[model samples]
Target: MDRLEKMLVDIRAFVAEREWEPFHDPKNLAMAVASEAGELLSELRWVKGEDADAHCREPEARRRVADEVADVAITLLMLADRIELDLPAEVHRKLVKNREKYPVEEWRGR
Candidate 1:
C-alpha cells in the first residue's frame, strides 16, 4: 500500500490497541481535531513568518507539532472511517471544488 494508506492502517491499529474507537464518535473526534489544531496554533501565538519556521526547527517544538498534527489526523481519519467516507476521493473532490472556486489564473492573496 501507499504511505497514506499505511499510515491510516497504523492509526487504526493504534486506536484499536488502546480500545479508543468506541469513544471516537464524530462529534468527539471533530472536537479533538479542533483542540489539537489549537495546540498547534499555540506554538505560534507570538511568532511570525521566519520566527515560526525557526520554532519548528527546534527538536522539542518539532516533536510537539508532530504530536498535535498526528492527533488531528487520527481524529479526522477515525471520523471519516466511522462515516464510511473515502478520504482520498473526498480530498480529490474538495480540491476540484476549490480549484473551481479559486482558479490559478484568478488566484491572489496567499
Candidate 2:
C-alpha cells in the first residue's frame, strides 16, 4: 500500500485496538483536531514570530511540538475518514480554487 494508505490503516488499527471507533465520530474528531492545534499553539505561546522556529528547535520543544502536530494530524485524519472524504482530492481541488482566486502572477511578492 501507498504511504498514506498505510498510515490510515495503522491509525485504524490503533483505534480498533483501543475500541475508540465509538468515540471517533466526525464531530468529536474535529473537536479533537482543534484541541490538539490549540496545544500546538500553546507550545509557541509568547514566542515572537522571528524566534518561533528557533524556539521549537530546542530538543524538548521540538518533541513537544511534534507530538502536538501528530495529534492534530491524527484527529484530522480520523475526522476525514469518518466523513468519507478523499483528502488528497479535496486538497487538490482547494488548491486549484485558491490558485484561481489568488493567481501566482497577481499574488507574487504580496
Candidate 3:
C-alpha cells in the first residue's frame, strides 16, 4: 500500500489500542486539528520565510513540526474514517476545484 494508506492503518491501530475512538467525535477532532495547526504556526511566529525554512530543517524543529502535522492528520483521518469519507478522491476533487478557482494564467500575475 501507499504511504498514506499505511499511515492511516497505523493511526487506526493506534486509536484501537488506546480505545480513543469513542472520544474522537467530529467536534473534538476538529478542535484537535485546529489546536495542532496553531502549534505548527507557533513555530514560525515572527519568523521570515528563509528563517522559517531553515528552522524546519533543524532536527528539533523538524520533530516539532512533524508532531503537529501528525496530530492534525490523525484527527482528520479519524474524522474522515468515522464519516466514511474517501480521502484521496476528495483531495483530487478539491484540487480540481482549486484549479478552476485559481487558474494559472489568471493567478500568475499575483
Candidate 4:
C-alpha cells in the first residue's frame, strides 16, 4: 500500500489493539489534536525568534517537539479516518480556498 494508506492502517491497528476505537470519536480526536497542538506551541512559547530556532535545534527540545507533533498528527489522522476523509485531497482543497482568500500577488514580500 501507499505510505499514507499504510500509516492510516497502522493507526487503525494501533487503536484496535488498545480497544481505543470506542473512544476515538470525532470530538475526542479533535480535542486531542488541539491539546497536542497546545503542547507543541508550549515548546516555543518561552523562546523568541532566533532562540526559538535554536531551541528546536537542541536534541532534547527537538525530541519533545517531535513527540508533541506526533500526538497532533495521530489524532488528526484518526479524526480524518473516522470521517472517511481523503486528507491529501482535503489539504489541496483547503490550499485552493486559502489562495483565493490570501492571494500571493497582493501580499507577496509584504
Candidate 5:
C-alpha cells in the first residue's frame, strides 16, 4: 500500500489500542487540528521571509517543524476517516474549485 494508506492503518490501530475513537468527536478533532497548526506556526514565529527557509534547514528545527506538521496531518486524516469523507477526492474537488476561484490568467505573475 501507499505511505498514506499505511499511515492510516497504523493510526487506526493506535487509536483503537487506546480506545480513543469514542473521544474523537468532530469538534475535538477540529480543535486538535487547530492546536497543531498553531504549533507549526510557532516553529517559524521568529523567522521572517526567506530566512525561515534557512531556519528549517537546521536539523532540530526541521524535526520540530516536521513533527508539528505531522500532528496536523494526522488529526486531519483521523477527522476524515471518522467523518466518512474521502480525503483525497475532496482535495481534488477543492483543487478544481480553486482553479476557478483563482483563475490563472488573473493570477499568473503575482
Candidate 6:
C-alpha cells in the first residue's frame, strides 16, 4: 500500500486498540481537527507575522510547532477516514478551483 494508506491502517489499528471508534464520529473528528488546528495556531499566537518564520526556526519552537502540525494532520486524516472522503482528490479539485478563481496573469503581482 501507499504511504497514506499505510498511515490510515495504522490509525485504524490504534483506534481499534483503544476502542475509540465509538467516540470518533464525523462531528467529533471534525472538532478534533479544529481543536488541533487551534493548538497549532497558538504556538505562533504571540509572534509577529514578519518574524514568524524566524521564531519557528528555533529548535524548541520548531519542535512544538511540528507536534501541533502533526496533531492537526492526524485529526484531519481521521475525520476524512470517518467520512469516507478522498482527501487527495478533494485537495486536487480545490486547487483546480482556486486556480480558476485566481488566474495567474490577473493575480500575479496583486
lDDT of each: 0.86, 0.93, 0.87, 0.92, 0.94, 0.94
Please state the error at residue 104 of candidate 6 in Å.
0.8
lDDT of 1 by residue, 12-100 (tens): 89888999878988888888889888988887788878688889989999998888888778778877887889899999999999999
The residue-by-residue lDDT of candidate 4 on 1-110, one tens digit each, is 99989989999999999999899889988998999999999989969887887899899999999999888898899999999999999999999999999899997997
Q: What is the C-alpha RMSD of each candidate to the true structure, in Å?
A: 1.7, 0.9, 1.5, 1.0, 0.9, 1.0
Q: Ranking by lDDT, best first?
A: 6, 5, 2, 4, 3, 1
Off by over 4 Å in 3: none
Q: How many clashes in candidate 5?
A: 0
TM-score (C-alpha) between model 2 and the true structure = 0.95
Segments in model 4 whose C-alpha atoms lie over 4 Å from true places: none
Could you give me the TM-score of model 4 versus the true structure? 0.94
Candidate 3 lDDT, 5-39, residue by residue in tens: 89889999998999998898889888888888898
Instruction: Give the distance in Å from residue 22's predicted Cα in candidate 1 to where it truly belongs.
Output: 2.1
Locate the minimum summed-lDDT window of 10 residues in model 2: 22-31
**How does model 5 score by TM-score?**
0.95
Q: Report the Cα lDDT for candidate 5.
A: 0.94
lDDT of 2 at 97: 97
lDDT of 4 at 10: 92
Say which prediction, candidate 2 or candidate 6, comes out ahead on TM-score. 2
User: Per-residue alpha-carbon lDDT of model 6 for 14-90, expressed as tens digits?
Assistant: 99999999999998998999999999999999899999999899999999999999899889999999999999999
As a whole number from 0 to 100, the lDDT of residue 66 in candidate 3 is 90
Model 2 bad stretches (over 4 Å):
none
